[model samples]
Target chain A: ETAVFQTPNYHVTQVGNEVSFNCKQTLGHDTMYWYKQDSKKLLKIMFSYNNKQLIVNETVPRRFSPQSSDKAHLNLRIKSVEPEDSAVYLCASSFLGGRATGQLYFGEGSKLTVL
Target chain B: QQQVRQSPQSLTVWEGETAILNCSYEDSTFDYFPWYWQFPRESPALLIAIRPVSNKKEDGRFTIFFNKREKKLSLHITDSQPGDSATYFCAASNNRIFFGDGTQLVVKP
Candidate 1:
């Protein structure tokens, strides 16, 4: 059983359009994260949430935002998307707090294409 | 600036040979080091990890050689197989992880 899940496996949108990607984890982990992989395959952290609390926020553009409605769900939204914003976005979860573990379980990524 | 750096953006190794992937970090607070692998059309997953307390960690044929003083670490895949062809990422974590640009490894049979 896959512990982490994501929706909208792929999306193609025009520049300036708004896009949203959804993520959920059934692993009951307290920490969730969003990562961006550019065309060059360079991976970078975008944001992280722990029990719905913002724990780590990278220097991302204002157009990008991470929304976590609960401990098990985290979403990523990009407004006024630019051509350079096209990339594969990955969601991951990890155990924190009392059951702290550094191992991360990642979901199949959402690929975004800006035209 | 990149907190973690990986060299030889790409590597090619013959099957049955040993492959080494290198990594270095700039942060001293990083106590946890983990290596992740992603096959084509697949999401990255945790492959192996190590702590500052140990200089080496081996999982079957995969081993991690860590140098705390140099802020460096490396992953070695022994008896490399075609199935091992993928992108390997090196990362460090305190509370969160900082990943290096992945190294794409290709194994030739």
Candidate 2:
């Protein structure tokens, strides 16, 4: 019973190409986050959106952007994908934003490979 | 600087043996500590969590020992089984959850 969902279990693209990953949550959470996991399995928070407001941008490149159509949906778009962008993209959602008390429900993840 | 540091990049234990995964944090303001477990090709899921108010929390075979003074915590898996094999991450947060590099554990049957 996965509350969060991500499309395209895996994607392989070339450098300079634009890519988009879609994420949706049915838990009715107000906060959504995007995290990148490298080959070493280190998870880093890239961006977070609370009530459709952007927060917690961790020095991500301008090419990387997040779009939220509504609170339940947050999408990640890479304008020009680079080889270094090859990693696992995970989407998670939680309730509220002040402090994380409840667990964050995560999607399986979308694997991106840029050659 | 890494906010959280986890030890033994990887660990292996025999079935039925207790396995301990250690973690330390640099942020004193972190009042909440949670441990997440992830399997290959799956997203990390919260296994158990503990607040600084308590020194220990237990759920079934998983337990979290917290040291608020030392800014450290450890996860103890009692009666470890093969199904417990996975990467375990230790996270701390006052506002946002900050995760450690994670420890890959393997339980040999």
Candidate 3:
């Protein structure tokens, strides 16, 4: 099954709580990305990693951090959840070479709701 | 600042109609443009894509019209079905991809 996988399809927590989302890809892609989709459907990039090396880090808050164990695994951890942090966190992966360049395969995003 | 912009935050159309979604970008260095579609409670999937070298690309009922001179592109979903109802995201890529605030399309049967 060549696809991206995300655990905890949905989660609900109160403010000041900590949460973590895990992602893994079996498509053998080189790059993995985290995108935050707000209630308004605005997609914002949070971080990107290539081969376990940080490549692109957007203007996200310090409370948010991304951990990559290998090219296939990327995890997001929120130290202290805020009300505004409630959104669908999407994990995507892509290949940088060959004919299928720029094509992103996404996981079934992890939805977070802060109370 | 939004690097990629999309218009008509929401659109409602009848089945078998053509739904046109508009998009524009700010960066000229972006050579790749792709449209991703997300169904309710589902993650986004790549629907169609186009490069700057070509002004148009088509797959099935979806077509992407690109204007590199103006840094604008549009997606046309012809013969839209109720299953086509989803949020469409326009994205541009250089070193990293920038996605626009998606346009929600509702196809009524």
Consecutive 10-residue window with the lowest summed lDDT within model 2 chain B: B90-99
Q: What is the interface RMSD of candidate 2, in Å?
A: 1.6
Model 3 chain A: ten consecutive residues of lowest lDDT: A95-104
Task: Write down the TM-score of every candidate.
Answer: 0.96, 0.97, 0.95
Q: Which stretches of model 1 miss by more than 4 angstroms? A: A97-99
Residue pairs whose backbone atoms clash in candidate 1? none
Please write out the lDDT profile of model 3 over residues A15-56, one tens digit for every residue.
999999999999889999999999888888899998899988
Q: Count the backbone clashes (under 3 Å) in each candidate.
A: 0, 0, 0
Q: Write the per-residue lDDT of candidate 1 for residues A8-113, one digit (tens) a residue.
A: 9999999999999999999899999999998888888899999999988889999999999999999999989999999999999998721244688999999999
- Error in Å for residue B13 of model 1: 0.8
Better of 2 and 3 by lDDT: 2
Query: What are the per-residue Cα lDDT tens digits for candidate 3 across B1-109?
Result: 7899998899999999999999999989887888999998788888999999999999999999999888899999999999999999998887778889999999999
Clashing residue pairs in candidate 2 are none
Kindly report the TM-score of the first chain in candidate 1: 0.95
Task: State the local distance difference test value for candidate 2.
Answer: 0.92
Instruction: Give RMSD to native, each candidate.
Output: 1.6, 1.1, 1.8
Relative to the real complex, the DockQ score for model 1 comes to 0.56
TM-score of chain B of each: 0.98, 0.98, 0.98
Question: Which numbered prediction scores highest in TM-score against the true structure?
Answer: 2
Worst ten-residue run, lDDT, model 1 chain B?
B91-100
